[model samples]
Target: MTGSGARSVYIASAEGDTGKSTVALGVLELLAATGGRVGVFRPISRSEAGERDYILDLLLQFCSVDIPYEECIGVTYDEVHADPDAAIGEIVARYHAVAEHCDNVLVVGSDYTDVASPSELSYNARIAANLSSPIILVVKALDRDPAEVKAVADVLMADIKSSHASTVGIVANRCRPHRRTDVLDALRDTGVQAWALPEEPLLTAPTMAELREALDATLYSGDETLLDREALDVMVGGMTAEHILERLGESMVVIAPADRSDVLLALVNANSAAGFPQLAGIILNGGLRPHPMIDGLVRGLRPTLPILNCEHGTFETARIASHTRGRMATGSVRKIDAALTLMEQNVSQAELVGQLDLHAPEVMTPQMFEYQLLAQAKSDVQHIVLPEGGDDRILRATDRLLRRGVAKLTLLGNPDSVRRRASELGIDLADVDVIDPTESELIDEFADAYTELRKHKGMTRDRAVQVVRDESYFGTMMLHTGRVDGMVSGAVHTTAQTIRPAFEIIKTVPGVSTVSSVFFMCLADKVLAYGDCAVVPDPTAEELADIAISSAKTAEVFGIEPRVALLSYSTGGSGSGKDVEKVQQATELVRERADDLRVEGPIQYDAAVEPSVAATKMPDSDVAGRATVLIFPDLNTGNNTYKAVQRSAGAIAIGPVLQGLNKPMNDLSRGALVSDIVNTVAITAIQAQNLKNGK
Candidate 1:
């Protein structure tokens, strides 16, 4: 995480049981760890609903939040519903009062106790906007379909966007194991980072302490530790001894009349037996206690189970027990630990924290950059093809992309092998177009066209036929024939193998002689484009100029303002060499070609980025210290520098995104994760969109 240094970030959801507290606890811990004054503010308190609002207590227990509980929370839901305008004003006033003493604030959004409405999203978005904070939306995924989850998110996000609020990320908590992938798939391309949290049994199961509180039962016997066990199931003791013995199981809470001596003895004997599971506890119903003789006998037996005596009748006690669900209150160390662990494993700290504008100048964050790429790609979904469909990563990424509707896909592989593998991974690829190159009807036509296209280079028709059989060539043929808008390869293949077909078939766009590449370098608080990192080694001054121009345009296409920086060992004529001279000449050419581009030249990497360094080196340059598009003088320098920043700064480098191709095509790193592939495909889709626009 960059820093839990954000002043305030609202965690919002319209549905109940969103496991919002667990999400809030995780974000709270991060904010608390910042070692600054951190606070939690709930815009609407749940205390007025006859239930204690423990979220503030849970966060206030941290050593960093010194404010009292009353100061951190705003008015109640009833108050808000009564006077809408007055409620927002009170929430703002209360939130600012807390913020005045804190370095960071994590605002918990209001609960929608009423029926779901578009006004719910609007109301929360308005409050958060008034608080001057971005949002992290939470969605409940326990029993909902993936599409339903997406629908819920779409509704909220649309409202958030229209209300002029923004979300850095969305979390689907209580997501089922089988539905995890599907939830993520549905949530993708929402223009924010998304994660699916698996259901944690402990967080949802009722503990003895919770049941005792809810029932208002008096613990007549056994020590306090006995109350810590959970009631995984329930049983009634009005039945016979044989029936009670038959139902013996672990973590079972039995409700029996205080005088049911037979059933009590049977349960005790079964629990003592080697094969029987221990009981969670026993409840003595109807305000009755054990007989003197029975009590002596039970004391002599030395049982460890706790006994709670309830004033309510048997039916009422049983009903109360059945309806008690778990609540995470302060001082319950075990449940809190489980909730924190669930959040830590499921939520992405890096992605969520990276979106925070914790520092100065409100830099373009990685989340902003990624969301722009995904939104632009999905705005006009493009048809893309993958050559390495045999790879599991490709199949998994394809499932996600298809589910997200980011792009229509065609896979070049043997259908049986691809389907078999997809089935093993529980992925449904029924909608994807699978083309076996050997059996493809277009293979002969592709071979003939290829032979003609390369005939001037002494290509033979038989050789061209065999070359067209390769999946890479077959995919290139698809793009050349306009069957798909773009292609992404190189998961199992090398970079040269992936791009060679494109270079031969699609060639360069008009007026583009040199092929170059750029990596969107995602740093802690900002996203920068590092160019010529994967292509055109030792580029001439003219090629360098072209790379700079293309990189700036790519930056702009995805919403980054382009301030071009041409890097070298020197800073503004301070050093003289062939490298420096080439960079200086490239800078002049960039300014000549792009009269509107803000460019700084022959600058060291430090001077190009750090404001203090820029102030010392090139005080008057506009691009110095503020460049979003960095063009290295050569490929070796660009590649090594990007890798260095990626490793040393823990930045995400999404690229080797190839430019200058007439058709949109990209090469992936062989070690790419499924997420990496998804991002690259989206980048390619946006590139295809631009190419289609003839930009």
Candidate 2:
């Protein structure tokens, strides 16, 4: 694992269904990208007669490995059972054969078909030693806590050590996502390289093809492509058709007796109707097929699901389908992508691959960036308040944030209403602190503080009481009084309503004269910071300079190294309009104040971002063509540019991240998606971290 010319690593697991194949595929992807002719090998095949092993097939299909299924396997499960000693030698010999054909080889080890048999770990360790490959241990952590994960990994490492097989790394696969950080910390205490990939439901949820095979069912009707969609839930169609309508949801597979034509009609009509969830499929249970007449009529409906018929009773069919577990097999494009991305984002990859002599800075994919952002936020958990809890987007985001251990949250809304809405969405927000501003004991105290702060504006206690009842004002008071770390609102309110409280209560930090914002423009290959898009309609030269300085610092806070560009319709003095002069003046002020910063002004957007365009426009400037932070001259230009890029390039604009705040409080677009709310909350948490450190 830590030597030059390192060629192989054995991906071994102590348990079956541990998702070790997914881990192997992820490592194979890293090795293949190292510019080598990579090959794959499986020591013991679980495959049946005249078929390839599913995991080996997956590695060959999705990765750059070119070896055939038949050539990759050394022995069958039966062959291993006959002579365990002989199987180890054969595995080594087979690995050599595959290794001879390529520059590197990845060997997948045994699946502990029976966890009770203590010999699987021993067998894998001996085989790994014989093959002279470093072992990367894969452990089951699906429902295990940090302590249990650590205890299990330590025991495995000791056993592998006893067998004299060198251990390189460990992966806690299918870990509880909320405890992701704890899992890594726990594994690292045992002193091997470690990482945890969070559990994704879709990866384990059985698809229709799996259900069909489980029930031994035949497709009676519908599109073939629908068979790959993962089942979200299973509903037995025993209830009346009207009751079935009550439980209808996305990706459901309804089971019913073949004679229940009413159930079939209800599902079919729901599919055609405007207000129903898109069904995954239906399973017609009980040894009877749908009547020929009923089947023909259902076929006339649009967007048909995969209607399957099986020869089992409804109870027996449901049992079979429920027990079906999905594998990382062929024809699942989405699961493949998700597995690779999840592994890629959550590993100590450089250490795992460094021994193979691969070295390059990875471009931060959006998935990677978001992962890092959440990790940063969770490093020091912050308390963030959501004033727009009535918005479903906010509540959903709150659920995700809590589940990921990203923040402690308080929602500003009526407790009953929030609880009722959360129940409808099937999300548990029971533990989240709810503050009904109107009914809070702190209302009187908060109103008193508000009146005292705004007395010069003719504010009285009675007037302050009314203002504090508004969620925004109350939430800001919570942050200002050190009751919460930050606040994210405006999903249902306007920007003015969300931040006006912040402007009055929390105010600006030291060295910042003007309040501004930056939208993290996540492009395909890189992320750029676009500034003052959602604030500051117009500014004088001095104010624009303050905006640039603040934006550059904000970019740095979020891991973007700032090379500032003051944008205009000009490029480095090529134009002579007043607008160009304004940008030029702001540029000078930025340089004079922040001499350590790399900044350029009167730069056109194309020249600021496009290297080819910069070559002819401003080739001599260090900030041109590679700017990470773009400072706009005015609101009209900045707002319009960010939106156009967001729509045209499909870039994710993850802000209006407010800068220059004493404490972190942010606004959201009214049309924000749940993902946007989650990201914004994370940003606020990170900002609170910086504030806590007095940065």
Candidate 3:
């Protein structure tokens, strides 16, 4: 099972003793041997020694993570007697944490009783629902007649294939050697995807050395000592700089003497090498002095590799490396390898999108599934509001989206005036809908509509009437009245002004308590959604919970299963006071109310992001280290923190997508360029669809 990146395989069972864990472990072992990052999570593990811990120990041998086991498994319940809902909550929390560290996670199932009682399986399915992981049902070949197997399989298949599941497949285990072909054919005939275990015994144990080699790096430094060579990609530095560049191209750790500038030059050259081979870092010999330039360059590229100044010279290091070669192929590759295998499984419509910003060219280019989804979405037209109507950039962008069958176009300006400007700018909008607020069918309607809606809200009829005449308010009203599906304004408005109309007329959806904004912060490896950066100046604990829940939902809508980290100065009871108390309370509230959400907070940004930092601080908290959704305490913290990460870390900030609105209407910054408008419009449209469906 091989692919470009990690893929996940979720495991369920038709009945107890189906051997889902054994199969999952086997797959994990196989894949982890191929230099893949694998992770495992049991959405429901009630066994005295939960299956998750077993898998965790196995994964630790191959992958690099310092998070404690308790944090990785959010809640541990009594094996025999425990509340299923409570168990599900803790399991989802833990599952999200593990899923964040790797590309794919193996979702293990709870126990399965007889087919006479489907509730047992149903409880496990609900946990999968909460985690939002794809599923693979494990069926026992023993004790099942053909009819019973098919019936049980059919029921499990339907349950796993509900709308909430991202994808699904099947694994049939331990078939009699002679009946294997017949059983496989029968299972395949059920129209459910399945994998049959081999008659030959499969070793499910993890081989550490194999994993080390798979990562294509040396065991210069690691937690374990039994370094395997096949799993080890030992980085050997030729005594010269040119060799370092040639051999280190995106490989692993490099060992050399510090006194050699030639070696330092080689170290520097290795980092800039084509594809930037994964240099674990330089292992300096004889504890020699490093050049200042080399030190600075290495510092510039930190966390990727660390310069280890050891007293041992090149000769001793080589001897250590030589001993590690044959042991690479030993560890279980289940989690990571399963993901790679599953990625190669070729499930239709399960597109693995790159973790980049929407503004990136790669995100916009239509892939097969995306093209089909967008094409089908064409019938669902949305009303788009552009602030500066006649600019070349705006018109060109609008034309491209329209030509691509994205949405029905609506330009906000006088038809004649816009026509004159479009002609001068050489932009064509011949068939686009051009509305002047002064003469708009919806604006005139919204002006009176706004007056009626806000008449009793401490505003006089004349005051409300005049306010509706304003562009922002009018634009928002059109969205509220269903005169338009959604609105995108603010090219000429500030955050307050653009959002004012929403606050005044549109307001929050009826049940929603707060209106918060989140910016989708995209990086090379992952996409994070940060909230309250553009709304809720200083939110209370209740408001913070609302923000976290809202942001989590938004992340789900964008194909990101959120691992929310509620950020603060402290982590996991590290600090005390009302501030920390607020965070703690909000975290509990989220766990209680938003049952499907995987959220943790009251953590520092470092603990929330860096696994190494998390290992040191709040090592037992599930949300520490691998959090994808970061919720800030107040606007001061949230706004400044996101901005800092963006500038300092070169993170791509997208959206600030306005949430808690009755309609999917968003405001752009006045300084928003044409591309920003395009992205905002896309996000607004998606939200509009979700709102209509009552999601």
Best TM-score among the predictions, by candidate number = 2
Q: What is the C-alpha lDDT of each candidate?
A: 0.81, 0.82, 0.60
Question: What does candidate 2 score in Cα RMSD to the true structure?
Answer: 9.9
Least well predicted 10-residue stretch by lDDT in candidate 2: 356-365
Which has the greatest lDDT?
Answer: 2
Better of 2 and 3 by lDDT: 2
Q: Model 3 over residues 1-695: C-alpha lDDT tens digits?
A: 11223355556775665655555554444333222245556554443542345544544443323345555554444532456566666666566666666554555565543222235566566666666555567778765555566677777667665535533555666566677666667777766465555322222222334433333434333223222111124455754676566665322556666767677665655544434443434555665666788666545553233345566667776556545422112243222333323323322222222211011121211121122234334546566666456554566557556544466667777677676544322234767777777665554566677777777776665666677666667667767777678887767668788777788778887657898999987654467789989889888889999899889888888766788988777887779998899999999989999877777778888888899998998678676788878898999988888889889876667777999988787777766765566677777778877777888
Global fold similarity of model 2 (TM-score): 0.63
Mark the 10 consecutive residues where model 3 has the least summed lDDT.
356-365
Give each model a TM-score.
0.57, 0.63, 0.47
